[model samples]
Target chain A: MKPVSVLKVLSIGLLAAGLVGCGKQETSKGELIVKIGSVAPLTGPQAHLGKDNENGARLAIDEANARGVTIGGKKATFVLIGEDDQADPKTATIVAQKLADQQVKGVIGHLNSGTSIPASKIYADAGIVQISPSATAVAYTAQGFRSALRVMTNDRQQGKVLGEFAVKHLGAKRVAIIDDRTAYGQGLADEVEKAVKAAGGGVVAREYTSDRSTDFTAILTSIKGKTPDVVFYGGMDPQAAPMAKQMQGLGLKARFLSGDGAQTQEFLKLAGPAAEGVSASMPGMPLDLMPGGKSFRERFNAKYGVIQNYAPYAYDAVNAMILAMEKAGSPEPAMYLPELVKLRFTGVTGEIGFDERGDVLGGAITLYHVRNGRWEVLDTVQGESAGKSK
Target chain B: MDIFVQQLINGLVLGSIYALVALGYTMVYGILELINFAHGEVTMVGAMVCLAVVGWLLGLGMAVPWPVILMLGLGAAVVACMVLGFSIERIAYRPLRRAPRLAALITAIGVSIVLQNVAMLVWGKQYVSFPALVPVVRYEIAGATITALQVVIVLLSGALMAGLWLLVKRTGLGRAMRATAQSPELAGLMGVNPNRVISITFVIGALLAAIAGVMVSAYYGLAHYYMGFLLGLKAFTAAVLGGIGNIAGAMLGGLLLGVIESIGAGYIGDLSFGFLGSHYQDVFAFFVLILVLVFRPAGLLGERVAERA
Candidate 1:
C-alpha cells in the first residue's frame, strides 16, 4: 500500500466520523426546543381525568406554535412533552426528573393533588414553572414557589361552602362526614369538619373509607346509628357513588353531599337511583351557565357525543396560558412568569386571575345536585362568601 | 340473616367474575408455567371490542336485540383474544421458551406494557360507558335485592366452568392437554402434540378471560384502558389463593375471597383496623394469599407435580 493512499483513506474515515457526529449534534440542537412538560395519570385508574388536563395543555401549545410566538426576541414555538404519572406521587417525581433532564422550561400538570404536592418540588428546584389545572390541595401552592400556580380553587373554600349549604340552605342541624383517605379526600374532609364545627352545627359522626372499596355498608350503618341529618363525603366519584348506593341500601336516608371530586356522570351511573337528591360543591359555574362554555359544550358534545366533567376548567386553563403568553409577548418562562402572575383574562369558566399565592382569586364555587341522573346547578357562591360561612 | 345472605349473593356474583378471569390465569400457568401477565390486557381488549361493536351496531341503525349483541360481543372478544394470545405466544414466549424463566417473565412484562400503551392509543385514555346488554333491573328474593346482571354473571360463569371441565375430561385434546401437563416429553413420545396442546390451553384461557371481561364491563357500566391492571391483580390473587394450577380451586377461591372482602367491609366499617373501608379489600385479599401460601404451598386443592428438571 502506498503512503499517499493510506493517508487519503484515513482522512476519508475521519471526515465520515466528523459528519456523523455533526449530524447527531445538529439533531440534538434543533433551535432551542422549549419543551412544555405535562404530567398526568395516563395509565392508571384516573387516566381519563389526567388526559383531560394534558389535552388542555396540548391545545395551548398547539395554538401558540401555530401563531409563531417569540421568546427573548427570537421566534420560538412551544413543544409539549407529556408523561403519565399514573396518579402516583413517586411516578410523578420520576416524570418530573425526566422533564428536568430534558430541560423543559415550563410544566402544565399534574392533575391529582397527591401526585402534584411532591412533584412540584422537583419543578421548583429545577427552575421550571409548574401550573396545575386541577390539583385542589390547599398546600399545593403554599410552598412559596414563585413559579407554582393552580388554575383550580383549594378544598378549603369548597369545604366552607359545603358546610354553609348544609346549614343555611338545607337547614341541617347535624352532619356526618366520611373521607376516602386520599390527600384530596381527607384534606377536603378536614376542612369541611372544621367549617361545620365553626358554624355551630354538630358533627354527629366521622368515618373513613378507601378509594378502591366498593362496599360502604358498615360506614353507613355507623352513620345511621348517629342519625345525622346530612352526610358529607370528601372523595372522588368512584367510591362516592357506591357509598351513596350503600347508604341507601343500609336505610340511611341522610342527604348525601360531596365536593367537586364527586361531580361526574360516573357517580350517577354507580349510584343509579340512589344518587337522587345528592349534592356536590364544584369550582366555577356549570358549562351551560358560563358564556363561553356553552359553545365549547356543544362542540364537545358534537365531537365526543358526551359532556365531559372538568372540560370548562380545562378550556379556561388553556385560555389563561395563551392569554398570559400574548400579554408577555414571549414564550420564555422567565419573561412570561411575571406577566402570568399579573394577567386577568376571561376564560370559558370565568374571568381568570391569580392571587399572589397562585390561587384563583375571586373564584366562584357552585353547588350542584344530581337530579334524574344529571348534574344540575343549585347555587353559586364566591370565595369570600364561603370564607364568611366558615 | 337476610342481610348476610344478600351480602353472600353479592360476593358470589363478584367472585364468579373474578374466578372466570382467574381460570384463564390458572390454566395458562398450569400448562406453560408462565403468568401471562398480559391476560388482563387481553380482557380489556375484548371488552373494548365489544364496546366498539355495540357502538357500530347502534350507529348502523340496527336495533339488534340485547341477547344478539351480547353473543356477538362475546364472539368478537373470543376471536380477538385468541389472535392476541397466539401472537404473544409466538413473538414473546416461543423464542424464549429455552431461556431462563426471568427472560420469559420480562418479555411478558414488556408485552403487558406494549398492550397497555396500545390500548391507550386506541381508546384515547377515557372511560367509555359500556352498553347494558342485559336489563339491570333488580329482583328481591327473601328480602335481598339482586340484579338480573348479577344472576347472569353467576350462572354464566358456572356454566362455562362446567363446559371447561367436560372439555378437559371428555375430549381427546383434553387427554393430550393432561398428558402434556403430566410430562411434556412423555406426551410428545405418546403422539400428543405438546405445542398444539399449549396453544389450545392459551386459546381456551383467552376465551374465558374475554367472557369475564364482557361480563364485568356490562356489570360496571364503564370501561377504561387501564381497567385491566387492578382486575388482573385481583384475579391473580384469586388464582394464587385457590392454588395457581388448580382449575376448580380458582373458582372456589374467587368466590370465597369476594365474600370475605364484602363481609369485612360491611361489618368492619372504619373501625376494623386495616379493614376499615372498601379500598382495603385488596389488602385483605393479599393477607389471605400470604396466609395460604405460608400454610399450604400447594394451595387447597393443588397437587404437587414432579419438577421438570
Candidate 2:
C-alpha cells in the first residue's frame, strides 16, 4: 500500500516536471533562430568528402553566430540540420523531402551531381533555396532552377581543362576513358570524350563500370591493348584510388586522369604512391590560395582534421546565403531568395555571384597532379572552350 | 593474344575471392539445406574486425612486425566470424528449422539486413581503408604482371581448397557431417550428434569466409560496410554455377566465372559493335547463367537432387 502511494506521488511530480520542462525549452538567446539544411552522403564511401562539406557549413554557422549576426532588428542564431543522403539519388530525394518537412530557411548541399540533380526539383517545389558546394555535373545547373546554385564550375569546364591538359601538356596522342556509368561520372566522361574527339585525338575505347565495382582488371586489360598514353576515369576517389593501383598492377603506363572526385588526400593514401604523376582537375581556386583559406584551414583543422577538397566551396555557399540574408535584412528564405540570385560578393572561394541558371559567374577550373605523393597545382584554366584546348 | 592473357590473369585473381566466399555458401547449404543469405554479412564482419584489430595495434604505438599484425588480424577475424556464425544459427535459423522453408529463407534475409545495419552502426558507414600490410611487389610472367599480393591470394586460396578437400575426405568429423547432411534423423539414430556436425560445418565455413574477407580487402586496400553485398552475390552465383551443394564444383565454378567475366568485359564493346560496353559485364554474367540453366538445369556439377518432403 505504501509503495503504491509513493508511485502515485512520483507520477504526479513527474507529470508536473515534464510540463515545466516543456514550458522552459521554447525561450532562447536566439530571437530568430533560422534553420538551414545540409545534405550529403555523410555515411558512405564518399562520407569523408561529405563530412568535410558539412563541417564547412557548420563552421560558417558558428562564426556567423560568434560575429553577432542580426536579422530583422533581432539577434539571430543559425541552425544547421545535417542529413546523410548516402550519395544515392533515391536517398537524396528522401533527404530533400525530410529537409522540406523541417521548413528550413535554406539548404546548402546534396553533394554529388547525381544527388543534386534529383533534389533540385524537390527544393524548387518547396521554394527553398538550395546551393550545392561540390556538384560539377553540367546538367545540374542546365535544368534552369532558380533555387539551384553551385559555387564550383560544371563538368563542361572541368572536362575541357582535362582534355587540353592531357593532350597539350601530357602530350597524349591517344586517350582511353572509363566511367562508373553514374550521372556525374558518365556526364564528365562524355564531356572529355567529346573534347578529345574535337581536339583531333584518337578515342581508342569508351568503357564503363558501376560505382560499386572493385575489380578493374577486365577493363584495364581492354584499355591496355588500345595502347593509349593516357587513361581518364570519371569517378570518385574510392574507385579511382583502386583503379590507379590496379593499373600499375597490370603494368599500364598510361597517366590516370579524373575530375575533382579523385583529387584528395584519401586518394593519395589509398593509391599508395601509385598515385604519383596522376593528374586531376577541381573547380575553384586552390585551398592555400583562397583569400580566407589559411585561417579557415587552421580553424577547420582544430575541429576536423583535414580538408577533403570541398570545404572551401561549402563555406562559400554558406557565406553566400548569409550575405544574401544580410542584404535582405531577413533570414526568411523567401525574402532572401531574390537577393541570392543577384548576389555579388567576394567569398573565400573567390567571386560569388549567380547567373540566371544559378551558376557561379566567372567560375574557374584548376588542374592538379600528384607529385612525390603529394598534390601540387599544375595550372588554372578559365573561359576555355574544348575546341581551343591549348 | 596479350589482352586475352592479361584478362585471364585478372580473372583468376578475382575468382579466388569468389571461390572462397562461394565455398562458405555451398558448404552451409550442403549441411543445412538453407541458403544462409547473411553469409555475405559474415565476410563484412570478418573484414571489419580485422581492420579494427590492426588499427588498434598501430594506434597503440606497438612495434609489431607486419606478418605478426597480419596473423593477429586474421586470428581475430576468424574468431569473431565463428561467434557470429554460431549465434546466427542458434538465434535465427535454428528456431525456423522445423518451420516452413520459406520462413527460414525470409529469416535469413532479415538476419542479413540486421547484420548490415549493426555493422553500419558499429563501424561508421564509410570505406575504412584497410592499411597496406602486404608489400606490393611485381613480377611479369608471359606478358602478364602479377603482384606479390595477387600471388599470395591465388596460391593461398588454392592451398585452402586442397586442405578443405582433404578434410572432407579424410576426417572423422567429415564422415559425421556427410551422414548428417544425407539424413538428419538417420544420422541421429546412428549416434552422430547432428547439432555438433552442423555447428562445426558453420565454423569451418566462417573460417574460410573470414580469411577471404581479409585477403580481398587487403588486395583492394579498402573495406566498406556494404562492400560485402556485391562480392556476396558474385560468390553465390559462383556457388550456384558450380552446383550449390557440391564442394569441388564451387572452386571450379568461381575460377571459370571470373575468367568469363573478365574476358567478356574486355571484348564486349568490340564484340558487340558499340551496342554494349564493359559496364554491362555484370549483365553478361547473368546472361551466361541463363544460358547455362537453359542447357543444363542441374548446373555444371550438381548431382540429381531428390525431392524434399
Candidate 3:
C-alpha cells in the first residue's frame, strides 16, 4: 500500500507539471509578447455579429503576426485576449476591468454604444486605448474620454441620411418611429426624429420596445392607427425580422426603415419574403466599392463564412491600432495615443482618420433597400451632405 | 375604435398561447403543490425540437405537404417534451417528494437552470427563425386584420382548453389525480396508485406546454433558447393571478393579462400624456399581479384551504 501511494503521488506530480508546461507560452528568445483585447457579446442574441467583430480583429492580429511586427526595435508577437460582455453594460465594465488587469495595451470593442459608453470610463482609467467597431451613439464620443474612438459613422450622420431619404426621396409625410430603447437605438431614433421634423415630415407616433422583446404586435398595431407613410425602427435584426413579418401580417401599408443594425444578411434570411422593400442605412461605402474591401471580404468570407455587418470596420479598427503602435515605435497605450489620433490610411472600409473628438473623419452613410431578397445599394451620402441636409 | 379592435384581436392571440402554457403550471401545481419551474424550459425544448425537426425535414427535400411537415415537427416536440417532463419529475423531484417544500422548490429552480444551459448548448445562442410553413392569409373583420394562422391558434387553444377542462372534471384519471392531490397516502390506500397519477399529470401538462410552445414560435416567427425564460415567467404570472392549481382561472387570467397588456401598450402614451410609451407594457402586467396579490391573496379563483404540511 505504501509503494502504491508513492507511485500515485509521483504520477499526479508528473501530470501537474505536464499541464503547467502546456500552458507556457511559446516565444522566441527575445520576442516581445503584445496583448490586444477584444470585447463583444460573444453569446446571446447578437452573438453572430459579436463573433464577426472578434474574428475580424483576430484576422488582423494573425496577419500582423505572420508579417512580423516590430515595436521599439524588438520583434513582437500580437495576441488577442477576447472577452465576452454578453452585450450588457454592467458586464462590459467588468470585462473592461478584466482586460485592464491583464494589461492589454488596447481594446477593440464593447460593441454596443450602451456597453461602450459605460466601459469607456474603465478603459480611460486604465489608460488603455479603446476603439469600437460598430457603436454609433453620439454620446459615446461626446463623453470626453480620450480612450474612446469608433471606426463607423455616428448615428447623427446615419440617422440624418435615413430621415432625409424617408421624406425627400420616399415622399413620407408623417413618419412613425419605434426604438428598442437601447442607447444605440434610442439615440439613433432621436436623431432621426430631429431630421424628420427638419425635413418637413410630421412625427406621428413614437413607441419603444426592449431589445429582448420579440412581440411588437401591440406597438405595431398602435402605430398603424396613425397611418404614417413610413415606419422607422431603430433596432437590430433579431427584433427587426419579426417586426417586419408582423407589419405585413397586420397589413400595414407603411414602408419600413431601420439603421445599420438591421443591415445584415441575417435579416434577409430571417425576415424571408417580408424583407422585401425594407430599407436601412449602413455607415460606409458598399464593400465592393472600398479600396481593399473586395480582398478583405474574400479573405473574411473564406475564414468566417459570412461578413455579418461590421467585420470590415472591426478589421480596420485592429489595423489602425497596429499602425499607430508601429508609428510610435512602442506598444504602450500612452506612447501610441497621439499617433492614433492623427493616423490616416486607406483601409478596407475607406480612408480612416479621426477628428479631434476621435470621431472617424469623412464617414459616408449608404442607404440600401431589400430587392429580390438582397440588399441593393440605393444611395450614398457623404458626411458633409448628410449633416448639411438637416 | 379600429385600433381598439385590432389590439383586442392581438391580445386574444397572445393570450391564447399564455393560457395554454399556464395550464401546464397549474396542472403540475395542483397535483404536487410544487412550482415545477422547469415547465417553461420544457416549453422551450418543445419549440427547439419542433424547429429542429422542421429544419431537418425541409433539408431532406421531400415532397411532403407543409402542414404534414408542421404536424411531424409538432408530434416530435410533444413526444420529446413528454419524456423530458416525466424524467424531470422522476429524476429531479421524486427524491425530494418527502423532503422540505423549500428543498423541492430550490431543486425545481436548479432543474430549470440546467435545462436552459442544456438547450443553449444544443441550439447555439442565436435566434432560430421559424420558417413560414403556413402560407399566411389575412382576413378583415370589424376593421381589424386577422391572419389564418391567428384564427387557427385561437380555435386550437380554445379546443385544447376545453379538452383539458373535460379531462379534469370528468375523467377517472383526473379523479385519481385529485385524490392523490388531496392525500397521497389516502389515495395509495384506496388503490389509486398515486405515483402513476402524478406522472400522468406531468405528462399531460407537458403535452399542453409543447403545443403552446409551437403556437408561440409560430406566432412570433422565431425561437431562441432564452425565449422560454420570459415566456415561462409570464405564464407563471398568469397561473398565480388566476389562482395557482385552478384550470379555468388560468385561462381567464391569461386572457385578461394579455388584453390588459395590449390595451395598456396601445394607449399608454395618451394615458400618460405622452410621458410614458408602450414599453411600459410589462410594468402593467406586474402591476396587475401586485394588485391581485394585495386584494385577493387566494387569487381570483382559489379557495382558502389549509396548508398540506
Candidate 4:
C-alpha cells in the first residue's frame, strides 16, 4: 500500500511540471510583440482630426499583419497602441515620454503642430522614428530631428502655392494676410507674406486672431479698409469659416484663400454661401483624382458613416512607415531610419519618396475651390518643379 | 464709419450670446456660491442633443420646414438639459451641500471631465454640422448687414433676461431662492425646502445655458465636442466682471467686453507688436477683468454689503 501511494505522488508531480513547461512555451511564443504607438488628441476639441489619423495608422497596421510581413527572417506582427494627448503641448510631451519608455518601434501621429513640435523633440531624444500625417509647421522638420518626418507638405509650400495663385490666377496686386495665432497658422502666414513680396505683390495688411475667438468683425473691418484684392488665411477650418462669413458681411469682397487645414466640409458648412470662390491648397493626390478614391470613399462612408478629408495622406503615411520597416528587415526604428530615407514606393497619395530633409520630395499640392458648396480641384503643382512653372 | 458700425453691430450680436451664458454662471454662483464647471459641458450637451434631434427628424422622413425643425430641436435640447441639471444637482452637488467649498469645486471639475469623455465616446469626437434652421437672410440696417439669425439670437437673449428678472422679482420661487441664498439653514427652518430651491436654480441656469448653446450652434453652423470650453471661460470672465453674484451686471459686462474685444482687433492691427489680433483679445478681456477687480471689486452693480461680508 505504501509503494502504491508513493507512485501516485510521483505521477502528480510529473503532471504539474509538464503543465508548467507548456505555460513557459506559450509565454515565449508571445514575447516578440512589436508595438507601434500613435499619440493624438483623442479626447478634446480636436478629437475628430486625431481619430482620423489614428484610424489611418490602425488600417495600415492591420494590412501589414494580414500579409504576414517577416522581420529578421521570422514572422512579425504590428500592434498599435494609441495615446490621447488632448492637443496640449504639455500632454503631448508626457505621452511621448511614456511611449519612449515602452520602447515602441515607431510612432505615426500627433496631428496638431503645437503638440507635434514638443513631442517630436522627445521622440528624437529617445531615438524613436515619428511621422505626422497632418502637422504642417515649417519648424517641424527644421529642428534637425532625423527621425521626425511629416507625410504632409509644409506650410511654406502651401503658402507659396496660394500666393502664386493669387498673383497669377486672380491677378491680385495687393493681398491681406490673417492668421489664427497658432504655430501652423503664423508659420503659414509668414510664408505667404514672404512669397507675396517676392512675387512683387504688396501685402496691404496682416491680421491675427485666436483659435477660440468667434467674432472677427473688427479684423474684417480693418481688412476691408485696406481694400486688398485677396485675403490669405493661415488657420484651420473652424476660424477660417467664420472669418469668411464675417468678411462677406462687412462688404469685404476680397477672394479668401487658405491652406490644407481649411479644406474640410465643415468650412463650407460654416461659411455657407460665402464660401463660394474661396480656394484652399492641400497636399497629396486630391480625393477626386485618386485611382481607388471612389471605392475608398464608398467603403469609408459605409464603415464610419462620415466622409474623410485627409484620408489618402493618412493612408499613405501608414503605408510608408510599414514599407520602411519591411525594407529595413527589422522592426527597430533606429535600424529602419536610413532604410526609410532610401525607400521609394507607390502609394495612394502618389509616388512616395523622402528628400534629404525627410520631406516628401516632388510631392504636389492640389488647388481646390469651393464651388456650389463642394470642393473642386483647380490645379496641381509639384513642389520641386514649382519654380520652373513661370 | 460704415465698417465701424457694422463691426459694432456684429460685436453686440456676439456679445448678447455671451451675456446669456454668463447669466447662467452668475445666477448659479449667486445662490450656491459654487462655480458649476459642468455648466459649459451642459451647453455642449444641449447643442449635441439639438443636433441628434434634427438628424432623427430628418431620418424619419419628416419634411417639415426648417423653422419648425429649429423649434423642435431647441425644445428637445431644453428638456434634456433641464433633466441633466436636475440629476447633477441631485447626485453630484446635493450631497456636498455642507462639504467644503473646495470639495464642491473639485467635484464640479470631475463632472466636467466625465461629461467631455462621455461625449467623445458617444459622439465619436467629430465636428457635426448643426442644421440651419433660420433662413439665411441678411438685413441691412444703416450700412450694417446683420443676419436674421443674429437678430433672433439677440432678441431672444434679451427676452430671456427680462423674463428671468421678472421671475426673480415677482415669483414665489424667486423669493424662496433669495431666502435660501441669504441663509440656507434659516430658509430650511422657515418651511422652505432649500434643496428644492437649489434644484430649481440649477434647472433655470441650465435652461439659459441650453438656449445660448442652441443659438450659438445655429449661428456658427458647427457644433463640436469642445465648443463650450472657450465660451465657458469667457462667460465666467464676464460673470466676474459684472460682480459675479449680480445678474444685471453680467449682461452689461458681457456686451461691454465683446465690443472692447472687437475694437481692439480692428484699430489695433500692429503686426510688429502683435497687439490688435484675435489672439490678444483674450488678453485684453483678462486685463479689463484685472482693472475692474482692482478699481471696483464689487463689480459695476454689485451690492457693497454682500461683497464685503
Best by lDDT: 3
- Place model 4 in a CAPRI quality band: acceptable
TM-score of each: 0.68, 0.79, 0.82, 0.73
State iRMS for model 1: 4.6
Residue range A39-116, candidate 3, lDDT tens digits: 888776788889899999999999999999888788888877777788889988887887787677899997888899
- Across A300-352, the per-residue lDDT of candidate 2 in tens digits comes to 99998999888988888998998898889887778999999887877777677
Question: Which residue runs does candidate 1 get wrong by more than 4 Å?
Answer: A1-135, A140-153, A164-178, A194-232, A237-256, A264-277, A285-363, A372-374, A382-390, B1-3, B270-277, B306-309
Report lDDT (CA) for all predictions.
0.76, 0.84, 0.88, 0.79
Clash number for every model?
2, 0, 0, 1
Chain A: TM-score in each candidate?
Answer: 0.78, 0.77, 0.78, 0.80
RMSD of each: 10.5, 7.7, 7.0, 9.4
Most DockQ-accurate candidate:
3
Q: Which DockQ values do the candidates obtain, in the order shown?
A: 0.11, 0.54, 0.63, 0.37
lDDT of 4 at A160: 85
Q: Is model 1 an incorrect, acceptable, medium or high docking prediction?
A: incorrect
Indicate the TM-score of model 3: 0.82
Which residue pairs collide in model 2, if any?
none
DockQ-based class of model 3: medium
* DockQ of predicted model 1: 0.11
**Model 1 steric clash pairs:** A213-B278, A213-B279
Docking class of 2: medium
